[model samples]
Target chain A: MEISSKLLEKAVAEMSQLPGIGKRTALRLVLHLLRQPVSQTDSLAQALQELRTRIRHCRECHNISDSDLCEICNSSRRDRSLVCVVEDIRDVMAIENTGHFRGLYHVLGGKISPMEGVGPQDLTIASLVEKVRGGEVRELIFALSATMEGDTTNFYIYRQLEGLPVTLSTIARGVPVGDELEYADEVTLGRSILQRIPFEGSLNR
Target chain B: MEISSKLLEKAVAEMSQLPGIGKRTALRLVLHLLRQPVSQTDSLAQALQELRTRIRHCRECHNISDSDLCEICNSSRRDRSLVCVVEDIRDVMAIENTGHFRGLYHVLGGKISPMEGVGPQDLTIASLVEKVRGGEVRELIFALSATMEGDTTNFYIYRQLEGLPVTLSTIARGVPVGDELEYADEVTLGRSILQRIPFEGSLNR
Candidate 1:
């Protein structure tokens, strides 16, 4: 689109750099900012700047935090021996909100995706392996997605800790709870059948 | 979502204020920004700040610009006596891209929407009426949407220019080009048949 003002064009160009946002959406967003009070735009800019300039990642888990050590790492109630490995802080939040998991987290930042040029070294795999070798964590739970990259990352990490004292486990993969069996994909349905647990185990949860 | 970092939560809160962006999408966008280089976020914040602080509206047309007069209003090639009234700069850009209309534009900024508490006084209708009464404009073409608010805005402006020498006209209502007539809505198809133009007139374009 032919924007009249140079400032407007520059704003749109920068806004479109975000994921899933295009030039048209950027224009619409910029126009919306223009229509609102000046303080709204100022606050948004200020908030993003503050977050980037001051945001810190937990030294142990690699999740975003405001301090040197994340709250979960500093907490005493969470089980430090049971570490749940996830992609990033978003996943950390999701698992935390479920109120089911009582373990600490190890954020890999991202999975190993060859297509995106992200290798094992790009994530926090080295730190996780070091933690396991330190003989503190009893079980390392792989809570990543079901994608190929997720499985590859899990296998890569599992290989890094071969013969270690820690026991490695992965989250169950099968049909989701509350979903109709007919709507479930064939692969998931097949996996659910093959990985069927005892009838008492289903009732205990 | 339960964001761990106060800074992250603040950024998401500010980002979610934009239209159509909820907390989840805001978190996703904010996390994407976090994954990129800090310089990208800095540039986006700077561009938005500059756009909101330095953006100006044209004195004559009311379109967003960097100077007192917009490019279309300042251009000598545009027809001064023939004005096309629109809702905002987006409409102006859409019409300008067609390259068919040579007339100048008068941006109303918004339409009359009672549901939103927006009335005639909120727009640039007064200056538009003054321009028409100045005895320079010979024809006033309204290019607003076909919604009820658009019709009310047009009628509101038309009532203000009662007995004025300028001729008033609205853009034609008809089925869109390349659209199958069978799929056209009943109201639009009925209007298109009722306001059918002569066959020779259609051939001229």
Candidate 2:
């Protein structure tokens, strides 16, 4: 049934386009918004609009920020010698929430999933190699997933930096197969990061 | 615990401020947004911002609209002489969604409540009275509520239109107590509207 007016219908339709929100849920949300004070709804609208205009991906770390550089990358208090590489910005956030890591981050945008047509060349691996070659960093932490694609991506990066003097290690294999790093609890993720193993040699292996 | 980075924390804080969303729920929503593609997230942000700037409450009917008057009020097909007086704009939407109501609406903003310090003077009761007295209306359907405050507000409006030649009526009282008119299903709500009762003259009885 048409449970909403035309304008409300349009608003709900737009909302339904968002991930995970279906038409009924969208209708409920729109109805809830209609009950709210105009100013309250206005704030939500303002925040969403400003989110894109104000926030950008940090060019250095690829983290979300309101400027070219993210707060983590710009902060001097962080450990410049240590860099944790991740598959997405959400991973950066999950790691940051632990507060034990004091290093910078490098978001790869995604893993090398050959089935999805994602290859090493499509990722930020080249930039990572450049960052390591820049001379200040002493350690490179691979905090990617334990999935097949993640393993493949990890091996590819390991091969690229096999001869570098920098200490190269992965966050660890304790993270379950097919599980994302962002979904691992802080205790598990932290333990995995702390117990990282050195890369055993070549991507061909 | 600092469960998210400062930027993510800030975004979560803002999200939790929305009605019915708590910290955990807000975090989930933020994480979901973080997982989306930059373009999709950007669209959500843009939609939110435009929701406020592009939309405004109709000056006449108080329904949300992109222009001065709501589409319903602007439509030449709707009956201008029949005004459906409602407790809020959501009620207007509820009726409009049925595709049945062909009349304009008058949003009272809220029901009269003494304990909550809300009274007739605090609402749009004066404007409603003025609208009825303008002599262009034939019926004033009070789709208020079945609660004490709703009854009181309806009574107040009925008294205001004491001498007006318009047919004064209260939306059917079968609606459950302390429930919002917006939650009633279209069939029940539509039936309630069709079965509206005349507000018989009685001061205290």
* Count of clashes, each model: 0, 3
Model 2 over residues B50-100: C-alpha lDDT tens digits?
554466777787766777887778989999999998887667757877676
Among all candidates shown, the one with the greatest lDDT: 1
Per-residue error at A94 for model 2, in Å? 2.2
Local error of candidate 1 at residue A84 (angstroms): 0.8
Task: Give me the displacement of residue A183 in model 1, in angstroms.
Answer: 1.6
Model 2: lDDT equals 0.75
Chain B alone, model 2: TM-score? 0.80
Q: Each predicted complex: what DockQ?
A: 0.89, 0.14
| Structure candidate 2, residue pairs in collision | A45-B48, A45-B49, A48-B45
- For candidate 2, the TM-score is 0.65
